[model samples]
Target: MNNKSITAFTLLTATLLFSLIAHADIINTNTTGRNTFSHRLSNLYIPEAVGGETWFDDQNQYNKLDIVASGTAAYADITVAGTVVGTTAEGANIYATDNSGIGIAYELNYSTPGATSPQYAYVYPNKLTFNGSGYSLNGYMHLKYALVRLTQFVPAGPITQLPTVTVNYHNLGASGYPDLSVVTLQGISAQPQITACNINAPGSITLPPVNGNSLVEGAQGITDAPQITLTNCPGAINNIIYDFAATYYNTHSYVNGIFTTKQGDGYAKNVYIQLQDATGTGIHINSPLTLPGYTGSGNYAIPNFRIAYFIDSGTLNTVTAGKVETAIDFTVIYN
Candidate 1:
């Protein structure tokens, strides 16, 4: 009975243990960063031909994501999911808008500490991997659009309300699979006008050979009028402004409409060239002139334009000629 009581009195002790683990979520702390960007296609002055040119590029402009995480650094994969409008000829993704001839292109980039270069993915459904430690994420959106001459047409006026696509970024490693952000990039607001014109000018204009002895100072020697024809002009244009410049000049003098010729070997000496209007009025070089009665979309011959060889009030008696050749440069501005 004593042994049984001693055995029953023997103390019994038990220990219960519990373990707890903590996990920190990855978060973008830059709350004030803008997610919506506006782009304007008209301001780029895109050419009529389909060349797959980048009309708008936000590479310099980026929405930065300041990532903060707590735990042992681990690799996490991020993905992009959005509505793909189409693909470019080079196989790049195109996020289209309500406006035609203009669309969006996007890329996701990630960088970690001591990384030589950042990792980027432009094509959709692509995953970008990053270390869960201190890292950065940048989202870039651009406009690398092509113009379809047959199907797409420029708007009559500037478009303000250009619809865009909504893109979602997901953290595949996050618990329950949470979205990093929902972004909608808006195109830049601008009043863009596309005015294109094709010019037809002779490669070289020749004047009748004249005798240098028959010319006097401050008098015209040989005169000629060459035509500058502008064709394939869009009907939406209102005016065409043009100006001229001398390629080779002996001196920096372009006083009235006269510019000096090159004064070296194979060049005429004491000789000058002058630009004039139809009334023989000396038109100032580099002065912009608007085409008269320019309606739109047709072939037009520039009026009141004439080029002539003249001698200035300098030493005309020493007018020795070897070759009286010069070049003229012209620029046309369409509005």
Candidate 2:
């Protein structure tokens, strides 16, 4: 070999021998299978490392794990693991990701700094979010906590937190799904948020909570609508806002699936008064509510409707009472 080559080889051998003497604790390394990095990388500072390759040396000290897939949509979790050498310390588990679980690294880091003493295993939470549905990475990753399915926690049978879609109105069919008639739901004070179909939460997409309310104009004989309670409910107590007039209507008819009152008939329109709390005078029932029966059809032909010709009469001013009150009951027809 040339003199320069021989000299360079001698220098490299000398450096390796010196390193072995200095850091005798350095462990061996290997190219573990996909996502698995079992090598003990020698400690070092990484300027700008990328993924899809092994960045560890032998000691597993400071390894730069650059994990990536062929395309942005290829879901894969960039997982790393570290095991403590002896019994004095506890084991730690940390993970990070994007979409299905991919993460980024800032400077080279092999474990959580000063988190667990004598960290038995290494891997910290460095998860990120991704743009799904035909969208490439485009460099969008939100730091988030990915929920690990509760299989490791909960008991067998099954536990579920139910979120409900409810509508409280008047004249709901005795025991069937609710309906939204013209006495109907215009818009909820909190629609987008309060309308949920499943439970775990509106993941990825969320529902906005319904808060305040304003009235809509719909006096047609069609009876499915919301009950508007007028007033700003604060601490407690209540006050009557409006008294409704319901004595004028004779009778109404539900044609096909709609509530239609005969023109100039005696069908009435009145508000139901209930002591929502204990604020109103002489409100004896705490939870007793005034429900108007629908006699405008079949069995409903009897009472047709109550609370008609009803007056606020100031009897609804308790913690249970509010201002002006009205209700619309119907069914949610699923086509």
Candidate 3:
């Protein structure tokens, strides 16, 4: 080969090597052509059934969460805002790709430093339209909240507060091109926490006498003759559900597989208690039942319940009546 041609080839190889070394530092870039991109995140506030906001859901299902942008930008005057919706349709911990089911939509607006009103620039997690360039179905822009299921019961207090969680995007690459900073979800607080009731309160129940005459006369034994109510409930404790866990009871009859026992001395009767909702329908003690969310305004009301007691003539030959008492450990399910 000629000396001039060899020199040109050597120069070309050197230039190519330099270019590769410079570009090696480029990890991720939000900037494309003349336009640049950025992002901001918001906290998800899950309010309790009583009142105020909360960050935890004991039932593993959250429906009252809302998201909003922090409106604070690190580079220039950028405004980000939008709504995000979460659904159980695609199962938990999964964000939807399309705008169809449930997801939040956020918009980022880029402008001069301290600009008051800027034009909307990008629609995140949905459609990104810029400089005659449009892109859809981008999963990188979606937001997600991973709720760890609570195994144990929360302690009873005036309010139960959870620790705050910080969410970071990604670190900035070599160029120091500001990465989509980090956002934090402030702690959540549940109001009017659950507590034990007084001994003579409405939550306690005492049944009337059940004898052979009553059992022979009626087929369903007895209905909730005297309605039971949960009194001293604040307006915050709007809706509630009850679950009973009983260990020992007479085997004469079964109320949804739950037996009733006659504790203490003095002519204890072999009977059982029948628990029911206000509608007189038997509720299973194992499975949980969710009542309607609170819809009332101002102060909430005391929740009312129903139950009936009957002598299990089907199991025992004779029914002895004296002190028909039993104990049941109940769990209060708050939405």
Candidate 4:
């Protein structure tokens, strides 16, 4: 089903409802120097369906160590039903794995105690489509179907590199769901490039229905379709560097021209407008990056906005204009 159908995470819901598996990517997150990739979210996002189980507890077995333990790797895994019917499959091998020491208890919210988490209790998101109910055969399956979410986390140090992720949301229908898979990203340009009317308008971004060389397997909606926005490093040659963030939609508006970044995290990248305004301009920094701006307009001009990220020098540079609107989006890529 589509991401919207994936449902919200309520308490320990996704964990108890579906068949589960937990495992870590054999690959570990890369850590170098200077903290370039630190503070960025992983491209991979756990489905609400997979939230809340005891599969990923830091204390259960994963060694109370954070996902970024022993370096900077965020680790977790899933267990699939692997059959037409689920929950009570006879002789079904529980194919999930976690970090070498972690038990099924280390989870997305295991670390943040006393704080609200996306996972908790038994409330499920409205996004998922459950074609069939999973029940343990003779009460055995329900006991083992418990699982947990795989969350990407930063433990203590800064990150230098981000693990590349390719997420595919599968299936749009209510039943007979689609599956998710990673695919090689492609397409320099795509069809559906819509135009605009005003200077603030971003025109349109062309995105294929599915990302990479292969199609999505079980889920659907914006998950399958991925857009690639390249914010080239300005003036930096030889060692190529750029900032990247993956999201569901191609071009997203802030609903009210309002966006917020955490204060201490040091994350305030530019909103790289792909198709600059009709006047060949794009917005960055928002001038008063922390202040409010006009997002509403009676005019037909659609102010283009996306959760875009642009590269910074890693260390803060002397700023005359504060952290607000650095320049039009293109400035980050073009000299």
lDDT of each: 0.53, 0.20, 0.34, 0.22
By TM-score, how accurate is candidate 2? 0.16
User: How would you encode candidate 2's per-residue C-alpha lDDT over 133-152 as one tens digit per residue?
Assistant: 22111121111111111111
Clashes of each: 5, 57, 6, 57
Worst 10-residue lDDT window for candidate 1 reads 142-151
lDDT of 4 by residue, 78-135 (tens): 2222221111122222222221110111112222332212323222110111111221
TM-score of 1: 0.50
Query: What lDDT score goes with residue 175 in model 1?
Result: 35
For model 3 the TM-score comes to: 0.37
Best by TM-score: 1
Please estimate how well model 2 matches the true structure, expressed as its whole-model Cα lDDT: 0.20
**Candidate 2: residue 168 lDDT (0-100):** 13
lDDT winner between candidates 1 and 2: 1
Give the alpha carbon lDDT tens digit for every residue of 1-335 in model 3.
65563444444444444432111121122531121212111233212232222232222211121111121222211222322333222222222212121122223322222221223322232221221111111112222232221212222122222222222222223435444432322323323233322122244566655555555411244444333334333222335555556655533333453456766678455555666666666556655554343432122232444556644446456656576555655555544
**Candidates 3 and 4: which is better by lDDT?**
3
Model 1, residue 184: distance off in Å is 3.0
Output the lDDT of residue 300, model 4: 23
Tell me the lDDT of model 1 at 84.
Answer: 54
